[model samples]
Target: MATIASQIILHPVVSQGLKFGGTTLGRDKTYRALQYFSRFFAWYLINKGDKIEAARWSALKAHLGTARKLMRLGKPMEHLQAALRAAFSSSPALETITTIARQLGYFGYLSYDAIVWASTIKLINVTKETAARVQKRAFQFWVAGIAFSLIHGALKSLRLAKESKALKASKTWGEKDLAEEASRETRVAQITAARNSNNAQLALDIFDVWIPASGAGLVNLSEGTLGIAGLISSLLGAKAQWQSVNGKK
Candidate 1:
C-alpha cells in the first residue's frame, strides 16, 4: 500500500534481516537504496509480465535501483530522503513502487513464487546456463502452486461437506458413533480418491527442477538457499508413498 520511496525507507527497518537471492540487506543508511531496487523489480514483474512472477521481479529491480542510488549518494541527504519519502506518500500512482521498496526477507516476507523468480532474475545477465536454470525453476514454482491449490481446494470442500452434515444432524444424533459412522464413507472416499490420483511424478515435479541445480550449486544443504524446492520434493515424495498405502484401503 505504501509508495516506493516509503517502502524503501520503512521496509529495511521493518523487514528484519530477510535474505534470499544471495544478499543480506536492511533499512540502515547503507542498505536503503538496494532495498528500493529490489522492490522496484517486484513492481515491474507484477505489472509488465503476463505471468505474475515476471511482473513481480520487474517491480523488485526498479525500487532496488533507486534505493541503491540514494544509498551511494549518502552525503547529507536526510532532507532528500524525507522529500522522496513524502512524494511517494502523497501520490496514489506510486503505490506499487513504494511497496516493492520496503523489501522482503526470505523466511519473513518473500513468498515461494517471488523467491523463485528473484533467483531467476539474478540469473539474468549472468550466464546462459544460469538463465536457463532460473527459467526452469520458475516454471516448477508455478506448477507447484497450481498443484497445491487444486488439492487444497478439494480437501477443503470435502471438509466443509462433512462439517455441514454433522451440523445438520447435531440435534438428532444420540450417539457420537452415529456421526462417525455417517462421515466414514465420505472421509474414506476423499482419501481414497486423493491417493489414487496422486502421482509421485506429479507430487514431486517441483522438486525435480532443483535437485540437479542444487548439486551444481554445490551447496548440498550447506549454505546459500536452504534448497527449499528440494525440501518440498522430499516431503511430497514421502506423502505420495503414504497416499499409495492409504489408497489400497
Candidate 2:
C-alpha cells in the first residue's frame, strides 16, 4: 500500500490509458471505462511506434473532445457522461472509417454500439464461412434434385433445405466450394428446380440491411436462383400487409 501511494505521488506522469504495471489499481471511473473498452480489442493500429488514431476514431471522438473541454476549465464535466454515451453509439472501426475507429473496434466490447461495430465485422467475415457452407449444401441439393427430378418430388424438400441455408447464412460460392465443379447430383437438381420454379427466390429471407460490399457491383437478386422465390415474396408481402394493418412498421 505504501509503495503504491509513493508511485502515484512520486512517479513520472502516466498517460490517460496507461497501466502502471504495478500492484496499484487506479480507481478512476474514466480509467475504468477506458480499461473496459480496451479489453475488446486485442490489437491496435500503430505507426512508427506510436498510436495514430485518437480523436478521429469515431463519433466517440466528438464526445471525448467535449469532455476534455469541461475538464480543462475546472467546470463540472456533467456532459462527459453524455459524450461517453454518444461515443458508444456505433462500432469505432466499421462506422468511422478512421484508424482510431478501426483500433477501438478491433475487439468486441461490452458497449452495445461497440458490439454493433464488431458484430457487423463478424457477420461480414463469417459471411464467407456461411457462403462456403451453403455452396456445399447447395451442391448436395443440386445433385439430389437432378437425381430425383425424374422421380418423386422428395427433392423439393431437399431443395428447400439448401435454399434455407443459403438465405439464412448468406452463403455463396466461396473459393473452396468453387474449387471443383459441384460434383453433387442433388445440388444440380436443386439448381434446376430453382430454375424451373415459377418463383424460386421465395425461400430466402433477405435482410433489408444493405452494406457497400465489394464484388460485382450489386447483382440483381434473381427469383430463379433459389426455388420458390415467389413463396418468400408472398410471405413477406403478407407480413408487410399485416404490419400495415396492425400499424406496426
- Per TM-score, the best of the predicted structures is 1
The global Cα lDDT (0 to 1) of model 2 is 0.34
Question: Number of clashes in every candidate structure?
Answer: 42, 34
Question: Candidate 2: which stretches are off by over 4 Å?
Answer: 1-227
Residues 1-249 of candidate 2: C-alpha lDDT, one tens digit per residue: 999998886654452224322212222224223332332121232222334452233234334423433333321132234334536666333222322222222111112222223333453344656545443443333233222222222334455566656544643465686533344445556665554441322222232101111111234433222212323333444444433334444
Q: Which whole-number lDDT from 0 to 100 does residue 190 have in model 1?
A: 65
TM-scores across all candidates? 0.25, 0.14
CA displacement after TM-score superposition, residue 133 of candidate 1 (Å)? 2.5
Q: Give the TM-score of candidate 2.
A: 0.14
Clashes of 2: 34
Model 1: lDDT to the true structure: 0.42
Cα lDDT, model 1, residue 110: 19
Question: What CA root-mean-square deviation does each model show from the true structure?
Answer: 21.0, 26.8
